[model samples]
Target: MNFFQNLALKYSHTMMQKALNNNLKVELLKEPQAKIAKEKSYMLYAHIPFCHTFCPYCSFHKYYYDENLAKNYFESLREELKIIKNKGFDFNAMYVGGGTTLIDEEELLKTLELCKKLFNIKEISCESDPNHIDPKKLSMFKGLIDRLSCGIQSFDDETLKKVARYHKFGSSEVLQEKISKALGILPIFSIDLIFNLPTQSKEQLLNDLRIAKKLSPQQITTYPLMKSNLTKDNIAKSLGVSFKDNEFEFYQIICEFFKDYTQNNAWSFSLEKNKLNDEYVSSHHEYLGVGSGAFSFLDGELLINAFNLNTYTTLIKEKQNANIAKAHFSQKERLKYVFLTEIFSGSIELTHFNHTLKCDLEKELFIELKALKICGAIYKEGDILRASKFGKYLFMVLMKDFYTGMDLVRAVFRDDARLKNKDFIDIMREDVDPLNAQNMEFKA
Candidate 1:
């Protein structure tokens, strides 16, 4: 790495560590309250932690699919939503994410139905794998889902095989057929691609992008692989993978190839106007998360649910909120988060920040904002601070650092939850030592 690039990476890493540490001193709440009174606009995120098969590179919380267990989990999920509703928090948009949220079609449909009935849901987006998108499922989701994102990590057969996704999802031709069928029914069809795999070359990444372009989906999200302790070993053993520093080159290729398309964020691009995209971080300042291992940002606090499925269901059944840990943010910390998310979404609106926070950004973040401008990472345009082409990559470094920090926290909690002991809650309250924090081996 060059001097400036190394400097930016180091700075972002430090800031991310600080942010993670600040949020690590969590409190175990006996009865967590869903704070939704102050925010007039927010989205609901429901996490389904179940998948038919686990990929070696994934870090999300998920369990092996079980018919009876999934059915009961959905029932508990419904009750959790009711708890939020009873607190007078209404949601208009919902995003369902997971380890193949459509693993069990019946349970997923039931959950979606309840979400619609409970709230005035105007738009709903769901995620699935290539294997789950069939004629039967597409028919059921025609009008109910506004956007359907399929995880087609890569089209390269070798890369897919190395990641343990090839056999489970089928060949490229099968995936294409499924994509075509979904395009005929879904309002907004999107596909996700992961770049910079250990075995992935520049040619492979370009080919993947070419296939994505050929598919002509309304939206495409190309993600960098973010590995945690849980999957790093598995990935290395299964794929002989090593982290590479070629992410910037791959990102540039996408930007150049899709120059005509609108940039939704650092990773997402769209061809159609008013299409649904996964820029949830920029869209809402506060959101409530339902289901196990989901995180929530509300009233200047971050709340996390217990990662254990059994404990989650048991807590909800006992008429208690599933929240196990809470981290409150300071005003400055909140402003910094807004600033970072806004910049990542393409620009920072100074007026909006000033109006919302009732404080001048130049004053609150004088040094940091000034440094960003002086370093040519951002430039001022009227009341907005926009990211330069180079700024996008630098901000991406920050985002990758932040997300890795989050995954590290999840990894620690996931391991603790596996013990199925009451002391796990107390362990979660303690801050993660900086030296002990799991660092991302790759740029992701």
Candidate 2:
């Protein structure tokens, strides 16, 4: 790395560590109505934390699927939606992510039914694994969901085996058949691929992209592996390989290979015109997250739901908010977040920053913005700030560090929740004591 790149990485790591360690404060809210009402526009995110098989490289909050438990969890999800509705919050779009969201077909249908009954949901996006891709499932989702994304991390059998997903998702040909069947049925069909795996080479990634392009999906998202403390250890132990820090070459290859397609974001490419991809990151400035292990951002505050499944259901049953942690951002921190998110979307409008934050962008983020420009990471075109070829990779590095820190925080909360503290305050006091009540404002 060059001197400037090294400096940028260091600054990014320090800021992310401080935000993770000191900014996030845990607390329980009896009623989160006032907080919910503050956001003018937002989407609803529902997380299903169960899967048929858990991959060792996975870091999000999830558990092995149980039929009875999943059924109960779906019912509790409905109740949680009712709670949000009662707070006078409605949503135009809903994004359901998970540990294989379509693990239980019946329960998923019922949950979508409840969503339709309760909210004026115009656009719905649901994520699934290859195991759930079939004509029957696609037919069921025809009208209920506008977009369906299948996680086909790689079509290479060896790569799948290394990740322990081969047996669960089957071979490349099997996935191709599934994708072929669902092509025309789903309105917006997208496939997710992972690049820069421990065993992945540029040739392998190029082959994966070729296969994906042949499938002719509406959109494709290529994600670099973001490893947390636990996942890093797990991947090394299972695959006997370590991940590399620099993926600039791999990212550049993708951007160049997919030049024919429209770049929707730093990582997503689309073949369809006027289609929305990367909804969670590019759709709304803020969103409300429901379900265990979900994160929500609103009015400069980040709210995280309890990671423990039982705790999440119990809190919902008792008519209390399931959010167990929150961090309120200072105006400067909020501006930084806005800028980062805009960069992820491929550009930032200087006008939007000025109007929204009511401050001059250069005046507020002088050092960071200037350094990025001087290092050729970003460039100005009229009123817009766009990520240069190098800047895109830099943004990815920043996001990876940010998410890795968050995963570590979730690990702490997961361990503490297993102790079964009577109140969230106890968890905050015992596990997150140093950061507690320092910059925290509780709604309890």
Candidate 3:
């Protein structure tokens, strides 16, 4: 059978099995109201789950490249897009993320052409390793996308080696030169920098940031070093290292520097428009993620594709004829998903919520958040809301609320009205601390 036929047969079989198990012909919940929808929608992400290599801290679903397998993957993805199109959904913003979307230039264009055909994208972006980008390939994206997010983890060669990033090298001067050439073709670019690496010093971080500032990309996102299970269980005998300077202290310094820098440059401001507004600050807001291990709050639902790429491919093949591995959300789950996405955009504007939603539970959460606002962990301007200087500075600390496990469990089992999910109960019972208040005072 051809790719489409094989895909259809697999999906049909799964639908049949589900129908039999439920003792009813399982029609998908296709009512217009039941459909996920979004307003002021911006950001679409496509996950290319084939990487040249993997980072230890990375838990993204991906595998090494294989020619025949990639063609199948593309076919499955095309089919998935058709299902969404048939449902009358479209997106405004677009982001294409790993496993490194810029693998082969020819294949990359084919994939991008498909995206243009599928989504009504206004502001499209793609992620790439520096090594993967060159003049001609970068030109392919001209007029097709507006932004480029590059993962230039470190300027320090030693740090890059320790993290296994395998990044491209040019002297800071040479690298910036090439980047400028690419920028002439692709505007609205940003760099990803990681701080607090194993045995890394604050001086090193400051130096890297100083160099990055010279390059003067519109934005620079710095994250503290974090260890996932891979690091914890790294039987490879990698050494463990703790913070040399207080991580929070380092974070505060970086935040202050960037805040002033962006303001002075007249780039753009985040959240509400302040007196110090700049185009650069205002534009860092929209993001979308897809693929196995990708998370997105598309429409009103918080959808997480399977974390296992193999499973994702299996399920997508099964989706050719009918739905495969269906999951749904509840009201509370919907709220949390909205909250998380807004939070990621660097703030939450209350004006976006319905007037009727201000009841007890929401009121309580707001009151708590407001206290943080007053103390300066977050900020509120009229109805618009955003992380305060301190909030953005110590984003890692505040991120706990979204991932307290309860939120995740709530998202996954949102469809069940009984609320008897074991995962939800377990997560809610965990001892994660509520948002800390000390961290709130003395804004960055």
Candidate 4:
């Protein structure tokens, strides 16, 4: 659809409008509350699950506003913080995400202030809708936060609508205006851009890339649209939108464009170099989770909160330990996990793999990657692994393959361990159904 045709498509009225008028005031689930540990260093994540409008591709836990409920949530959050403080925890990274973090100007400021009260935060970041940030609001955030990640997915209007984005493209201009209005109160910031939006084209993407280069956010994270049955399928159909078959090709173009902008022709993308140097990388930081559906890494375990908001609130109120469920990864699994994470960041080092892991990527993984290297996929210089000019767009998929192979290797190790235990004969005993049991014993 290129950009224009997709932009002109109207949303069909067939889709059910989500029921909006619900009194979500007061805690929906009331359980005993926990005593917060104070003065301890730990990360904090507060999820605000309300959005003015929903985007089709979004898969976050969110809901519409009930003023009273919003108020209660904030109070509950403050109480939650008190509990954390009493527990003697301190956090260096604080990220408040979703449902539009900055809806009410005054309230948002108070929330920011409250965050400061809760943690000795060094790098605090929040996600904001374009509408949430104006001159006044951006100023409020100036000293309160170290970074901002704007959900400015695309500058192409048609593509924005196809994705059900609430604001228009060039909205970054408004963001820029707000930042300018703050008069030297700019927090290091980044913008999110999605490419290969249903039926989008190379030229349209390149045009959007040029605008991104001009805006010159400290960093840019480009992602491809991931469709799911849970979101706006009708709107997607209306636009005749679909994923590109040749995704890797689209990825190469994006990588080349950005690499050139950053290196060869730095003039166009030079505006935010200083900010990039000063601010901490947003997603690259080690994070901790709070609130519903948030995941945090602690003591080599991943703790995930209940996905249901009601369940989360109930657990919080009942003071039923927030440690509801946690998954512990072994040292080998952790190494594989780190490798996967490193790949997402566009690079990894050979030295990162310690001697204990049983993965041999020297031939199957790295050699194959080099031999059949997609134009912009990866580059190897000695031990350092980095993405090439065309690799950035395809990086996510490439990383997926690495994880897939790593999983196979992990599975092999498990099989080897089981074999060493000599459980093969004993395992057959457990599965011995009358007919199969006799056959199994005969085979053995």
For each candidate in the order shown, give its overall lDDT on alpha carbons.
Answer: 0.78, 0.78, 0.51, 0.51
Highest-scoring model, TM-score: 1
TM-score of 4: 0.66
**Measured by TM-score, how close is model 2 to the native structure?**
0.89
Candidate 3 residue spans exceeding 4 A from truth: 1-43, 166-181, 233-239, 243-245, 263-290, 296-301, 306-311, 314-333, 343-346, 355-364, 400-444
270-388 in candidate 2: lDDT tens per residue?
89664455557456767889898888888888887877778889989998778876777787887787788778778888888688657787788999899889887899999999998
**What lDDT tens digits, residue by residue, belong to model 3 across residues 1-444?**
345433433443343233222221111122112234444444555777777766665544467878776666666666666655565567665667776777665676776677678878666667776766687888887888566667776787666555565343444455566666665567566666767666667788788788778777765667555543223344123425553535656765676666655431111222222221112212323333445555444443334455444555676666532222223444544454444434544665575454323433346466546545555555667776676554553334323222332233223222322223343233223311222211111100
Off by over 4 Å in 4: 1-43, 164-184, 232-235, 260-286, 348-394, 398-444
Residue 345's lDDT in candidate 4: 52
Clash totals for all candidate models? 0, 0, 14, 35
Model 4: per-residue Cα lDDT at residue 250: 68
Return whichever of 1 and 2 wins on lDDT.
2
* Runs off by more than 4 Å, candidate 1: 1-6, 30-36, 415-434, 437-444
lDDT of 1 at 331: 84
Q: What tens digits encode model 4's per-residue C-alpha lDDT throughout 129-172? A: 77765766687777786766667777776666555662542444
> Can you give the lDDT of residue 383 in candidate 3?
76
Provide the global lDDT of candidate 4 against the true structure.
0.51
Candidate 1, 334: how far from true, in Å?
1.5
Q: For model 4, state the Cα shift of residue 167 in Å.
A: 7.0
